[model samples]
Target chain A: MPVIKARVTVTLKNGVLDPQGKAIEHALDGLGFGGIGSVRQGKVFDVEIEGADKAKAEADLNAMCEKLLANTVIENYSVTLI
Target chain B: MKSAVVLLPGLNRDRDMIAALTKISGKAPVTVWQTDTEIPDVDLIAIPGGFSFGDYLRCGAIAARMPVMRAVAEKAAKGVQVVGVCNGFQILVEAGLLPGALMRNTSLKFVCREVKLEIANANTAFTRNYAAGQVIRCPVAHHDGNYFTDPETLARIEGEGQVVFRYAEGTNPNGSINDIAGIINEKGNVLGLMPHPENLIETAHGGNDGRALFESALGLPKAA
Candidate 1:
């Protein structure tokens, strides 16, 4: 069985307020970074699983995201195999 | 009435909740640990506030998936009364026992202060002692106390009288939608609120405004 690597990204859903992102946007403006349309903060997780089955690994990663990696209520998640 | 308090690591308010319950009910509440798969029979289950699992992934997100939470969910399903305060409220939402989600305060700062709370609906088991539209003082302390939900869900909850408490008198500390400070489940047995009612249940605490909530849930006569 080969080791499968994956990455999961989680971001706040649209229309949900992002206070941390807004703070960063303000800080960037203070630093003279101009013309920034907007800013949104998110989280990324790099995971490694020991398995030769790609489909099973993908399924497991999605399950992990649904159960723990991301809160589906206010956040969206994506999984990419590497 | 017999009561129990859920215990999880990084939670700092178990002692306060236990003391409040003990003082109010004249009996010490049993403490349930995070890994426990079964909870003893009790009338009320209270989950106190704190930075559970260090607020990893999200506030209350990690703790919500613990074994004890499954037991709590089971108890809630059976029509037993459940109350969650602060981070406890966050856990309930994360565990899918309650609607909506608590997010980072819109001010991006942790708020630890007193706020006025209005009894939006006094008909539930938790707020029966207070009159609808009555305002009381309670302390709220948290970084992610901002409550939010989709428009449809919000409308439904509002229409159903599930919105039990609201921040009143321009004291919405976390930018919660509709100034919501507390809410109950559709069945009205489960309640999750951001304020610390336990902290204000006695005259020594400066007021006993929060005592009636416990009295209501515990089926005790209204406090004199």
Candidate 2:
């Protein structure tokens, strides 16, 4: 069996307001950084799992994202296997 | 009426709820822990305010996934009266027991103050004691109580008269859309609100305006 590493990224939906992200963007400008248009903060989860194939691991990771890792109402999540 | 308040770790308002229920309903609500898969017999179930799971992920995201919430969902489906206050409301929404999502306040600040709310629909189990469109005061304390939903869903809830409470005009503390403060489910059995009615059950706390909410839910006579 091959061990798979999964990375999940959870981010607020585009239309949803992200105050923390906006605050961070403003703070970067105050610190003299230039040319950064916007910053959106999000969550990342890394997990290691035992799986025989990539397809099965993707399916399992997708289930985790739907059930617990992210709230679909206000957020979008992406999964990547490494 | 028998009531139970779900207890989640990091939740701090269960005591206040217990006291209010005892004073208003004549018995302290049984405390059901997060890990419990079943709640004892009760007529009402309350999810009180607090930073459950330290409000990690999202306000109610983690706690909603707890084992007890499955039971809460089941009980709610059976038409048991359920109310979630503050973070409890967040948990209910996150658990899919209610509609819409609570977002960060439009001001991006944690607001803690007494806000005036108008009883939007006073015929529900939770607000029958209030006259339709009557105004009452309750304390609201939260950073993520701004409610959001699609226009279609919003219109549906509004048309169905499911919106239970709205922040009185000129006193919209959190910039909630349509000045929403609380709402009930389509069946009129589940309520989720940002304000803390439990904090105003006694006159010493300022006023007894919140007392009627409990009385209404318990089907008790109005307090004098």
Candidate 3:
């Protein structure tokens, strides 16, 4: 099995509560920043794995997402394997 | 020393945490409901991991406003050892017990697994048993553990060595800048982490790393 890695990022899509991001926006406004369109908050995951086959690797990666990585509610997951 | 676990409606790990706590405390921790204003006299107050109030209104936002939290906050001001795990962590950040807030993962998902953490600063009361830079395993299960803080605040946390634990290597599990896993208050008494060490209490459960947390509490009571 070759050593593989997964780089994943999770973010609230647009128009979410994003209070943290919103707070930053308001803070920026308070700091006299102008024409600031918006702010969004998200997290990133860098994972390490060992696998022989690419197909199995993909399946395991998907399983990792479905079972643990992503909640599939109120958020979205994007995976990038390197 | 007496200790209590704050039990919010959606908190699912109260029993597990209490079970782990008993090993060091020599007695089970009291569970206090969210609606209650009074927190029993204890050396520490634990905000256990779980989907408090279904994680609505943001991860810990609603819990921070809970009545029990108000009491918790007051005691924390007096230097009480208030530890928050997962949802408890979110609540602490939401309540401003610790700096920074946990935002959605860049992938926007809930993560649950045994994670590797490097003990970043072990001088604090909660991490004194662990060696600095040593790595330990614990479970992290959360949707909003991406820790975010402004640059100046980040600098202060770093300068003051308030960060207690961080992800090992480049395993920036949640896109958390600095791979932060846990942080302590300015006084180093309170700790909040996205991982659930309480769930890793026994070897049968995978490991006994969680015991150290309670062990650190042995010499201290919940409050003055």
Candidate 4:
């Protein structure tokens, strides 16, 4: 049986302010990289599941994202299998 | 008054809370570990400050899911008075015992200083000793103390007098909307705030303004 892998990316909602992203953007500009546009910071979690059932793995990953990987109030998450 | 302080891994302010309660109530408070699923009947339950679970996966997220919080949540539902300060506020929000969420400070800085707070409502069990609209000074120390909630909820809370404290004029230290520093649940039995009132309960710490909060919860007269 082949194992399954899921990648979960958590990012702040579109309207939520991102101070860390702003600081990074400013720092890049200070370093002469003026072309860098607005930046949004996020977290990525790579998880591996034991079974080959892709559907079950997706469901489990979604549950994890909803319960712990992301706070839905301030964040949005996407799940990808690779 | 019989009080209990919930303890969690990485919690650093339990002692301060214990000391404050002992000083005010003339006896030590009971300590309940985070792993415990049931709480003894008590007049008040305090969730003190400190970076629980190392502030990982969002501040207080992990601790909010602990077994003890379920009991706390149940107690709150049953009209038990619950007060959470600093990181405890975060845990309360994450546990859904309170509304809104704390975000990173707008300046991306950890603010550690005394701030002036205007008592927004003094009718609740937690603030009965304070005069309505009174200004009190307390210390706030946190990196992610900015409180945020949707506009609808904001209007509702304000309309219902759920906002308990507001940063004094020109004293908004963390960019919270409407300069809100603390709020109570819909029923007013639960209170959560970013300021550490426990740190201000003694004259040696600059003022005893915060003492009224604990005293009021215990049904005692205001400190002289």
The residue-by-residue lDDT of candidate 2 on A5-33, one tens digit each, is 98999999887778789999999999999
* Pairs of residues clashing in candidate 2: none
Looking at model 3 chain A, report the run of 10 residues with the lowest lDDT sum: A66-75
| lDDT (10s digit) by residue, model 4, range B146-181 | 999888888999999999999996888888989999
lDDT of 1 by residue, A3-72 (tens): 9999999999999999899999999999999999999999999999998888999999999999988888
State the number of backbone clashes in model 1: 0
Model 2 residue B40 distance off true place after TM-score fit, in angstroms: 1.9
State each candidate's clash count: 0, 0, 22, 0
Better candidate number, 1 or 2, judged by TM-score? 1
Which candidate number would show the highest TM-score if scored against the true structure?
1
Model 2's number of clashes is: 0
For model 3, the stretches where C-alpha displacement exceeds 4 angstroms are A1-82, B220-224
lDDT of 1 at A79: 92
- Give the TM-score, chain B only, in order for the candidates: 0.99, 0.98, 0.94, 0.99
lDDT of 2 by residue, B155-181 (tens): 999999989999996888777778989
- Which scores better on TM-score, 1 or 4? 1
Which rank order by lDDT, best down to worst?
Answer: 1, 4, 2, 3
Give me the candidate number with maximum lDDT: 1
**Which of the numbered candidates is closest to the native, going by highest DockQ?**
1
Expressed as tens digits, the lDDT of each residue in B53-112 for candidate 3 is 787746877788778888998889888898999889988987778998787775556777
Considering DockQ, where higher is better, how would the candidates rank from best to worst? 1, 4, 2, 3
The candidates score, on chain A by TM-score, as follows 0.96, 0.93, 0.75, 0.94
